[model samples]
Target: MRIYPIETGNFKLDGGAMFGVVPKVIWQRTNPADVNNLIDIAARCLLLEDGNRLILIDSGLGNKQSDKFFGYYYRWGDHTLDGSLAKLGFHRDDITDVFMTHLHFDHCGGSIQWNKDRTGYEPAFKNAAFWTNENHWQWATHPNAREKASFLKENLLPMQESGQLRFIQRGDTSFLEKSELGFDILFVDGHSEKQMIPHIRYKGKTLVFMADLIPTVGHIPLPYVMGYDTRPLLTLAEKELFLNTAVQNEFYLLFEHDAHNELCTLQHTAKGVRLKNTHNFDEIFS
Candidate 1:
């Protein structure tokens, strides 16, 4: 089996919002912000290649939102999902599975796109099955007011409408062993209800996809949580447990939103679980 980091696109988000309750004086040392108070963010997806299946972990924000809508985010990049796929000699059609870590717009927006002639929406990966758990599907569809804006309808619905949407069978435990998509899943509810973090076994190493749970290396600290989260206290507990487990298992974390630091390892420090090392995707897997 092989894995590749698919950099779909890059955008900027308010640093204050990204680092919740943390002072700019502290977070700026790790994730420095611009004069506009925005920091660079990447919609870095992951692709898994094993025999006949080409599974994409998450699809970044697509090019379907209105210009006015996008202007708010300040997206600045030359990277396109198609170009990234082409570099690896693959196409959207080649993806057999589009496994979503969650249904947030920035995470799953690329899964749907406008049809020809600017008609209604359609699945971007026409041949792939869109994956999300039953709990998340319901939460996103009938979103609470706090997360409603992030859970855009256009980014969703198409997969379900196309009859290609699928859900992983999750038990009551926080972790599910051997999910249908050929990986273990950790269900954390702090970021969003039942956010599935994939534990992929590749090349004698376990890579954990740090979706919103630990978006960037800056978030390695237990207290550095995102302001967007619904339950910060729950996040504090979940993050502490996950970080400790990650350090114990020597897991390589794959950051979905971190533009500078793609992958990192953790070690026990005097303070707590801290970053041990950072690596390029190819430095290890290649």
Candidate 2:
């Protein structure tokens, strides 16, 4: 099996929102903010190539939104989803599965695109089955007021409309063991309802796709949770449990929202689990 890092692009978000109640004095040290008090964020996706299946985890924000809509996010850089795929000698059609960690726009917006006629939306990965859990599917489709803005209809409806949408059946256990994609799903509800974090066993190491649960290295601390989360207290507990397990198992965390750092391992520190080492995709695998 081979894993590739697909960088869609970078965008800026309010540092305050990203780090919740954590003071700017603390978080700014690791994730320095710009003059506008916004921090850089990457829509970093992962591509898993195993035998006949090429599974993509999380499609970044696509370029379908209006200029006015995009202006709010302050997107930067030359990277794009199609361009990244082409660099790896692959195309959208080569993807057999799109495993979405959640349905937030930045994470799954690239799942759909405007058709040739620009009349309506169409699946971005024409040949891939778009994957999301049943609980998340319902929560996203009928979003609450707080998360409604992040779950855009344009990013979701196309997959369902194209008849390519699929759900990973949840079980009584914490990890779903029967995914055909060859990864264990870790469900956490703090960030959103039933957010599935993929625990992939690759090359003698367990590489976890750390979606929004642990977005960046700066978010390693238990108290440093995102303000966007519906239940901040729940997030604290979830992070603590997940981090302890990650440290014990020596898992390589594949970050989705960190711009500078791609992968990291944990070490038990006086302050609890902290980042041990940072690495790029190639460096870790090589």
Candidate 3:
């Protein structure tokens, strides 16, 4: 099995919101913010190539939103979903499975795109089966007031309309029974309802796609939770347990929104679990 880091694009978000309760004085030291208090963020996705299946985890924010809608998050850089796929010798239609960690626009927007004449929406990955858990699917479709803005109908709806949407049961180990993507889904609810983090066993290493559980290495501290999380207390508890397990087993955490740091390892420190080392994705694999 081979895994490629698909860097879809970069965007800026309010640093304060990204690092909830944590003071700017603290988080700014790591993820330094500009005068506008906006910090760089990457819409990083992962691609898995195994046998006849090509699975993509999290399709970055597609270029379908209106300019007014995109004015908020300053989407920059030359990277794109199609360009990144081509870098790995593939295309959008080459994808067989799109494993969404959650249905947030940044994570699943690329799942749907404008049709030829730009009249209606269509599945970006024409032949792929979009995988998201039943709980998350419902939360995104019937979003609450706080998260409604992040869940856009244009980024969704089309998957079901195209008859390519598939829902997995939370905590079900059998989700991968029929797939070639040798991975298991780890469910966490603090960020959103049942966000499925993929625990992939590759080349004798356990690499976990750290969805929003620990978005970046700066989020290693249990208290550095995102303000967007519905249940911050639950996030603290879940993160503590997740990091402890990650440190003990030496798992490589793959960041989704971190602008600079990509993969990192944790160690048991006096201040609890802290980042032990950071490396690029190719370092371990190459």
Ten contiguous residues with the weakest lDDT in model 1: 172-181
Best-fitting candidate, measured by TM-score? 3
Q: How many residue pairs clash in each candidate?
A: 0, 0, 0
Candidate 2: segments with Cα more than 4 A from true spot:
172-182
Off by over 4 Å in 3: 178-181
Give the per-residue Cα lDDT of candidate 3 at 70.
87
What's the lDDT for candidate 3?
0.90
Per residue, candidate 1 scores C-alpha lDDT tens digits across 1-286 of 6789999999999999999999999999999999999999999999988778888999999999999989999998788899999999999999999999999999999999999978799999999889899989999999999999999999888889999998887853322224333478899999999999988877788899999999999999999999999898999999999999999999999999999999999999999999999999888778
Give every collision pair in model 2. none
Candidate-wise lDDT, in order: 0.91, 0.91, 0.90
Candidate 1 has a TM-score of: 0.96
Clashing pairs in 1: none
- The digit string of per-residue lDDT tens for model 2 on 1-286 reads 6888899999999999999999999999999999999999999999988778888999999989999999999999999998999998999999999999999999999999999999999998899999998999999999999999999999988889899999887753322234334478888999999998988887788999999999999999999999999989999999999999999999999999999999999999998999999998888786
Q: Is candidate 2 or candidate 3 better by lDDT?
A: 2
